[model samples]
Target: MVHLSRMCTLVALLVALAGCASAPEPQGNSEILNLQAEAEYAYQLALLDQAETLYLEILRSIPNYAPAWFRLGNIYSRTGRLDAAILAFERCVELEPENQKALYNMALVRLKQSHQIISLARRQNGVDPQVQRQIDGLYQALLRLQQHTPTDSN
Candidate 1:
């Protein structure tokens, strides 16, 4: 009778262990959404590198995640990675054409790049008139975007 009781107890322990092991792990859309939320929270906390990592992870899981792409671009822009930021913003725009933040960020990064180019050109012997005109155009575009951005109440 003791041996039988021990065998029953072992079976019960095994069943409990199996139940714990089989607890549902997040997958599919839920996992992706959770990652995206975590990334946004990290960004809000100004943990930009952590946010970038999470955003990239989300992108890997769901390539068309427009908000993550936009936030990643913002983080890159803050870190002065203008080229990378521009590429990310472009991806965001491609994924969601109506993403105003992505459009603004793309214009801002392009303006910054154009300014750098113009400065370099000025330091050199000769500056191209066409290049200067293009820089002026980007500046105008950036100004327009800045004017249109909604002011944050906080």
Candidate 2:
């Protein structure tokens, strides 16, 4: 026969496992899933404005959702809203540090902003030293990102 202490331990383990097995699904999981599907569909259709609104709605409910952040960044980048794009991508990276796609998009947005600044400076006669320094910094950042990013052969 088993010792009393060992029997108690076995019973406790069984009880814990039973509780876990009976745990109910989280509330609103299906709602969130539906919203995510709608957002992805809008994004695929290139309905950027609609997608952006949907993403914002999802984020209000789940602020830490990295995919919504990434999609929002893409919409902002395509709409020429570089500043907003950077912030959205940065948030996505904060939530999922290993997300290479968000990092790459951030670099692209920064490069576009740099090009715009340079163009404006040229049109105004000459580049300001401070502006030139900022552009150089952006270039250095891009080089660093490229060096650290892994290439996908496929």
Number of the top-ranking candidate, with lDDT as the measure:
2
Residue 12 miss distance in model 1 (angstroms): 42
Question: 1-154 in candidate 2: lDDT tens per residue?
Answer: 2234334533553453345546764555556667767988998898889889889998887787777888899899889999999999999888777777788888888777776765565456435887777756766666676567553210
**lDDT, candidate 1, at 69:** 76
Query: Candidate 1 on 13-96: residue-level lDDT in tens?
Result: 345334555576434545665676798789899899999999899778667666667788888888989999889889977876
lDDT of 2 at 126: 39
Report, for every candidate in turn, its global Cα lDDT versus the true structure. 0.70, 0.73
Q: Which regions of candidate 2 fall more than 4 Å away from where they truly are?
A: 1-27, 127-154
As a whole number from 0 to 100, the lDDT of residue 66 in candidate 2 is 72
